[model samples]
Every structure is written in structure tokens, then in C-alpha cells.
Target: MTRTKLLAKIRQVFPGHDPEDVQRVLDEYAGPERLRVHLAILKLCDEDRRDSPRHYVDSACQDHRDVLAWAESPQQLRPDWFSLSVTERAKVAKADRQQYARWLAR
Candidate 1:
């Protein structure tokens, strides 16, 4: 999404707050994670059609929930994935891949 659209969505999600400050926090803390979380929220809220197939949107929603569960769990030894830098997010994604592989093997 464009910066303006993202800022507007952030404002809508967090009303009565400064949009500039919200943008700064999102840029610094959430980064790409913002898109996943926001998309999941939008899908669940369903104020508009997301222009994606229902299955694709459902998968995104599930992935977002998994990320949230991981972030909230003590097993997530590193920083919260949402707050991590791009490099850190990559590392976490790698670890998650391995974990999923192991789960599948069981």
C-alpha cells in the first residue's frame, strides 16, 4: 500500500492518536509485520473485499494468528517478530521453517 493509505489505515485502527506518531511507530517497530497484522485485521473485520481469493485471505489470517501466538509465547527466545529488524525477521522465519519441518516429520 502507499504511505498515505497505510497512514490512513493506521489512523483508523487507532483513532484519537496522532497519525504522524502512529506512522513513526509503525515504521520503526512493525515494519512489514504491520502489513500482515493489518491485513488479517482487515480480513476479519471485512469492511471491504480484499481482492484476493478467499483461500489466500484465509491463509494469511491463519499465518498472522500463528505469528501472534509465537510472539506471545515464552518459546520465542528472541525479540518479538513484529518488532525485529529485517535481518532478525529473516532469522526468525528460518527458525520457523525448521520448526514446521520437524512438526511435519512427527
Candidate 2:
């Protein structure tokens, strides 16, 4: 459950996706759950608003509430969230949680 392993898993899950923004999340985090929440949240946020094939939240957020709520859900997910080690956390989060659900379907 180290950061390196977690990052590798993330890359596997999102082969072509950029890690820069996700890296931002990792830098702020002390451990794996933070990484889990970030990837889960990022996937959720990106999926909710897919104007393109890429997986990033709109750089220009005309609608912020959806992403905010999506962010909030992770707080509730912490108990189950904490159980996951840095390694399994992302796999669990990415598979179970469909992040983009919070956003408005355009």
C-alpha cells in the first residue's frame, strides 16, 4: 500500500489518462485512502461531464455543485474507505463508485 504501488494501479486503470491532476491530489495526501478518494473522485467528476474522450473535469467549471457533491461523498465512504490499503483502495473505489454520477448529463 505504498504511494508507488497505488500510482501504478491508477495508471493501469486509466491507461491513457493524465496523472498530473491526480498527482496534485497525491501530493496533498498522507496515504492511500487519499489516493483512492482522489482517483475515485476524479473518475467520477470526469465521467459526469464528458464533452470529450479525455478524463478530466472541465477546466472551465460552469457547474461546480455536482463535482462538490461528488467530493463530499468520499467523507461518507471513509469507514469502508479506511479498510482499503493503499494498494486495494483504488481498485475498490474505481470499480464500485461511478464518479460522474453527480454531474449534470449534458
Candidate 3:
């Protein structure tokens, strides 16, 4: 998504948060080969931990292993999971498969 649309989505998902902080979190966490911003936010929401996007982004960046493990098992699977685009879902699913393959290879 474009920066403008991303900003709008973040504002919609995390109302009352400072836009500056949201942008910073986006810049730090969201990337093509890294965390998908929408996925992170959806995961956070599924875990009922939507305190702020910054908190999620910080933990995801600094303690990615734990964050990824958390993503593997949400407290409850939310319908919002369907909100992800087909490409995003496929990418994450493929990543999961690769991760599991590596784990199995170990």
C-alpha cells in the first residue's frame, strides 16, 4: 500500500494515536522482506494487545523471535485475518512453510 493509504489504515486501526509515532513505527517495522504492517497490526489485535502500534513494532523488531512465535498462535483467530490481501497471505504462508522446513532440517 502507498504511504498515504497505510497512514489512513493505521489511523483507522489505532485511533487517537499520534500520526508521527505511527509513521515512525511504519518506517521501522513495515517492509517488503520483513514485517507487513497490516499483518502485525492484525496479529496484535488478535492477541488483544492493541495498546499501540509502536509497542508491537518495537517488540517485533527487537525481539522478533518471540514476536514470530506469538504470531504462530494467537489467543483467538480473528475474522480480520481475511482482510489481508491474497498476495500477503500467500507470502506469509510461504514464509511459515520455509521456517518450518528450516526447523525440521535442524
Candidate 4:
């Protein structure tokens, strides 16, 4: 399935989940470790309590934050960013970049 459809499904599963938080969870949880459990919980949440994380952006995700921060820093961007999901990575990229910059400076 496409990222858009996946994100939409996730949103439906957790209406209160911050979109950025969903993205972060997606990035981090796409692993063999918690993959099954997370997906199951997500499904269970859909059936029972569909709750989403509040702060989705990874403060320590320098790479992801860097991508976004650089994009809007000099107001430059990679063409690939446009090709990616407009809502998730791109939006967080902007915020993460800003937040990341400060976090890194210290």
C-alpha cells in the first residue's frame, strides 16, 4: 500500500494521534522487534481504544530532522522531498529541523 493510504488508515485508527507522532512511530517501529506487537496494538486500539502519541517527532532523530531543517533553512529542498508524502515527513521535516537545530546547538 502507498504511504498516503497507510497514513490515512493510521489516522483513522487513532484520530487523536498527532500526525507527526504517527510518523515518528512509523519510522521507529518498522522493525522486527516491535513490529508485530505494535501493529497488533494499533489494530487492538482501533477495535478498543484508538489513542495516538502526542509528540511524534524524534528529538534525537538528527538525520530526519536535518533533512527537514535544511529544506526550509535556506529555503532549499530536495526534489525527493516533494515526491514523498506531503503531510508526514515534509511537515515534520520543517518542525523537526527547527526543533533539531536548537537541540543540536546545545
Candidate 5:
């Protein structure tokens, strides 16, 4: 539901997940997208045999990097862009605009 509540759930599900990684995702994505990413990561924990949750955060951030790269250079499309979840795509679209603004201001 809320970001705070979502963070609590993530920490509970993957106690080993880094708090900073979780916070970065929360700050980078909006409410709905954040929830989707959380759910996706939780699902990964279910299917993955790995003892670490660190990579889950990496997966969540992958789309962010892809989006940023595309926004910085839209002529080159990311091959894996289509593989991202709808929520991730939408959030990145929104974030890309903000990122451009920040870049432009600099």
C-alpha cells in the first residue's frame, strides 16, 4: 500500500536485502510501480534458490539504468526494454523526463 508499509514487508521477506538498496528503489519509483517491483522481487525469492536477496534489488534497478540510458540517448533502443514489467516501463518513462530535466539544468 504505502511506501513505509512496503519497505517493512520487503525487509520482512528478505531480511538479508540491503536497506539502502530498498530505499533507492522506493525513492526512484512511484507508489504503484514500487509495489509491482516489490511483488516481483518477492516472487523471485520464491522461485530462486539463492540464499541472497541482493540481486533482487539489482533486477529492480536494471530497468532504471536501461531507461536512463535510453532517455540520455533515445536513438538507441535497449534490447531488453520489452522484457520489463508494465509498471517498470511506466515508472521509467516518468523518471526519464525528470532525469532529463536534471541533466538539462546541469
Candidate 6:
């Protein structure tokens, strides 16, 4: 998504938070590839359960290790991850796979 859309989504997801701080948090934690993965997950969740983005963000913030664990699972099992465009999926998948591999190496 474009920066404007992303900023808008961030604003919607984190109501009451300062927009600049929200952007900084997104940049620090989400980055590009992770943000794509998160957006895909949010989109799928919207279709299935209609949970607010805050729910996912809160969960991630509460226990990031669990989020990493979930990402380490087979991508084929995550329809939301797969729902991403092929290029986007490749970017997110490759980045996450490398991150998980590094964690394993450590």
C-alpha cells in the first residue's frame, strides 16, 4: 500500500495514539515485509472474524515470540499469507524465512 494508505490504516488501527508515534512504531516493528504480512493477515481476519487491527497489534505487542512462532510455521498453512499477491508473498516469505533461519542459527 501507498504511504498515505498505510498511515491511514495505522491511524485507524491505533486510535488515540499520536500518528507520528504510530508511524515510528510501525517502522520499528513492522517494516516493509512484516507490514505486508500484517496487512494480509488483517485483511483475511477482516473477512473471517471482523476483528479490529488493534486486536492483532495488541497480541503481537503482548507476546512477540508467539507471533514469530506462528510465522515459523509452514506458509502453505496460512491462507492469509498466501492471499497476498505473488510478489508480495515472495518478499514477505523470503524476508521472514531469512529472519527465522537467523534465529535458528543463533
Mark the 10 consecutive residues where model 5 has the least summed lDDT: 67-76
Off by over 4 Å in 3: 30-35, 42-49, 63-106
Show the colliding residue pairs in model 5. Answer: none
* Span of ten consecutive residues with least summed lDDT in model 4: 53-62
Question: What does candidate 4's lDDT look like per residue over 1-106, in tens digits?
Answer: 3556456656767777675677667566443323322333344344445364222223223233332333234232555655667675666567756753443332
Find the 10 residues in a row with the least total lDDT in model 2. 51-60
Model 5: residues with Cα > 4 Å off, grouped in runs: 25-32, 49-106
Evaluate model 5: give its TM-score. Answer: 0.35
- Residue 13 of model 2 has an lDDT of 46
Q: Flag the better candidate by lDDT, 4 or 5.
A: 5
C-alpha-based local distance difference test score of model 3: 0.56
- Model 6: which residue pairs collide? none
Top of the candidates by lDDT: 3
lDDT (Cα) of model 1: 0.47
- List lDDT for all candidates, in order: 0.47, 0.47, 0.56, 0.46, 0.54, 0.53
Give the per-residue lDDT of model 6 (tens digit) for 1-106.
5666656655554556676765554444453356654543343333345434454455566665444445454463466875788997887778767854553333
Best of the two (1, 5) by TM-score: 5
Question: Could you give candidate 5's per-residue lDDT for residues 1-106 as a string of tens digits?
Answer: 4666556655655577785675665455533465655544544453464444456556556664433343343423557768888887777677756654553333
My TM-score estimates for the predictions, one after another, are 0.31, 0.29, 0.44, 0.36, 0.35, 0.36
| Candidate 1 residue runs with Cα over 4 Å from true position | 30-106
